[model samples]
Target: MSRARAIGCDGGGSGARLALVWDGLRHEVCGGPANVTSDFAGAVAEVSGLLHRAAQLAGVSLEDLRGVPAHFALAGVVDERVATRVAAALPLEGVVEEDRRAAVRGALGERPGHVAGIGTGSYLARQGPDGFETIGGHGLVLGDEASGAWMGRALLKAVLAVEDGVEPATALTRQIAEEMGGVSGIVAFAAEAGPSDFAALAPRLLDAKTDSAARHIIVAGADYIARGLLALGWKEGGAICLIGGIGGKYADFLPTQMQKALVGAEGSALDGALALAMEQDG
Candidate 1:
């Protein structure tokens, strides 16, 4: 760990990835979710444990990573003061930044392009010489349109609308209502659901084939995707790399010209984080 030159982390609602660099070699480790907003102390503890495990995996101790410069790309870090506090809990000298930048970097590298990452959260960004210009990713309550969490929450709300006799109750609504024990159960689930909890409900919507209501919800999310893309200055033929679990699903909803501009990711957030950590070392 003392021989470590840099540390890089890609952390989100699902999990965390850490890369320890020594000379030209990189040792990577995986750990629990590190979304600081959902569980601050837990996130710090998970990171601390991962670094300790990484040190052990490298046949060293946590003490050896004393001054390593770590660049952490973590979800749920909106407050600068909170970032500073998270940094203080790390085993090494580190910086905490929102996960969106890493998504953009990993998807496009230094090449100018746009990125639409839609997983538990959503964000759209344009990568350029001045760094990333982004929109959305305000988390579930205020924003994150087209995200898994958003889609899931929308589905439940639509089901409730069906209960109220305002919206049509398609087969999808009936199925969900039945499974959740009708109106009462759906309401209960919503009451306690966090982003990841709500996101777990998106797969049914994702897997829909003949459900009109499901399509409607997804289409609305796609509309936001189009808006976010345009707001970031996307035009016909502009490269847009989709990232995360739900990003590719929206391509069909966007205009055909925009779909034509879609490209596969060059790397992942972990790669971007490691690259940034290396940059900090230099």
Candidate 2:
């Protein structure tokens, strides 16, 4: 059975996408979240499932997927040790890397610039002639400062502050508290919350125009994004491409100079993944 020549996947906290290429034909599919660091076993199973489904949809045998190389860009795969684990566990033959390069390559291409990806997690990268260098995206526990999960976690902290009388309640805090069944419920939710679960609550902060508490969280996230970029050698007038669900939302909070230097994305992270896969196969 003739199979795909190359396969590409972009998996993050929110969801995962897979694409297979053969000659000029292509097939793509979306699956559940795959965060290797957070849930290693589950993430591998999810990628395998996507490949089976992709095979069926493309009218190819599942066995045909054998030996095909994949460039899998997954969140929570922050280092070589984790990458080795992911590569060894997967059913496919491929190289697994942190999702930052794909996002940076897809967003900025070869153009000298910076990219800030803020979705379920956060990663900042600078792409230049020297190739790509990145920072952050250490994951929810330590880094991922400007990510959706960070904003969500920050919001819950603010609610707790209001409950303890350390901070005044705003309409946003009161509303969120009521929705989550008061302080006790909020604590329970946090106890079991994963990155996506926390990230789900970030939308409230994104749309809260007059909510001081929400603004505070958003501003703090923006501050981290700016600082992280500076640490990565960002300069004035350097093109900064923001990607991901929460990435573009920070535009309003960014310094006026950054906003001016902002540039539109050339493509998506998945596009970058596919390009890398084909390059590796060749």
Candidate 3:
């Protein structure tokens, strides 16, 4: 029997993760500051480096990787064109799936139903054994209106409001700014933040959800998310698992109506990647 090895990679805007699974054991290799969809060469190089590292750690060589299959999950990889571009960047032979799918697959344990991923960015998708279909996830600039970036942007607007003397900066806003370093720091950091960074800030926003402005923004994001989920055909009867930073962390804050929409889950994106790697090709 040919020994099998599974490789899974999730490349977000903030960072990249390479997960390797073999013989019921899982190992991870990380690579930098790259978004494959946005930076073609950088994506290729980062992914290559991650793969090389994983192989090294696993005591496997490049020659060993030539035969094993990889399941790659990448952020900002939307549509077939983006997938094709990333496919070229990866050297391993196997299947390619969008980060959202990978995340959902990971989150849902390859099961079916509707899943909403709200993190630095937001995306809603449906998956079944047959395949997966996307509802929304256009990134912060266009879509992702209900995501962490959306909240961060709203928080910034609130800060602007405070600056303009429209209203005092709430305690929550002050705390968020302080925790984030400072107003100037947030400005500087946001200027170059990736999806993961924005998602990572969900906690700060949640902390301030009590304030009027923070509440407004968080509810607005949840509303957008709920709308996206409904658009994807998520029904109260179906299984709906919320993934991503905001989704997982702020589960309690979601409207009761939205809460009733979800069932339960087996694992997370990380687990999903491990499971994806474990499956053998027919």
If scored against the real structure, what TM-score would every candidate get?
0.87, 0.82, 0.78
Judge candidate 3 at residue 252 and give its lDDT. Answer: 65
Candidate 2 per-residue lDDT over residues 1-282, each given as its tens digit: 223477889997678999887555788999999999879998999998988888887788778877776789998886799999899988878889988788787897668999998888888889887678988877799989989999899999999999899999999999999999889999999999998899999999888956999999988988998999999998899999999887999998999889999999998888788777766735
Ranking according to TM-score, highest score first: 1, 2, 3
Q: Highest lDDT: which candidate?
A: 2
How would you order the candidates by lDDT, starting with the best? 2, 1, 3
Model 2 worst lDDT window (10 residues) = 1-10
Residue 224, model 2: lDDT of 92
Top model number, TM-score:
1
Worst 10 residues of 1 by lDDT: 1-10
Model 1 stretches astray by more than 4 angstroms? 1-5, 59-69
Go through the candidates in order and give the C-alpha RMSD of each one to the true structure: 3.0, 3.7, 4.1
Q: Which is the winner by TM-score between candidate 1 and candidate 3?
A: 1
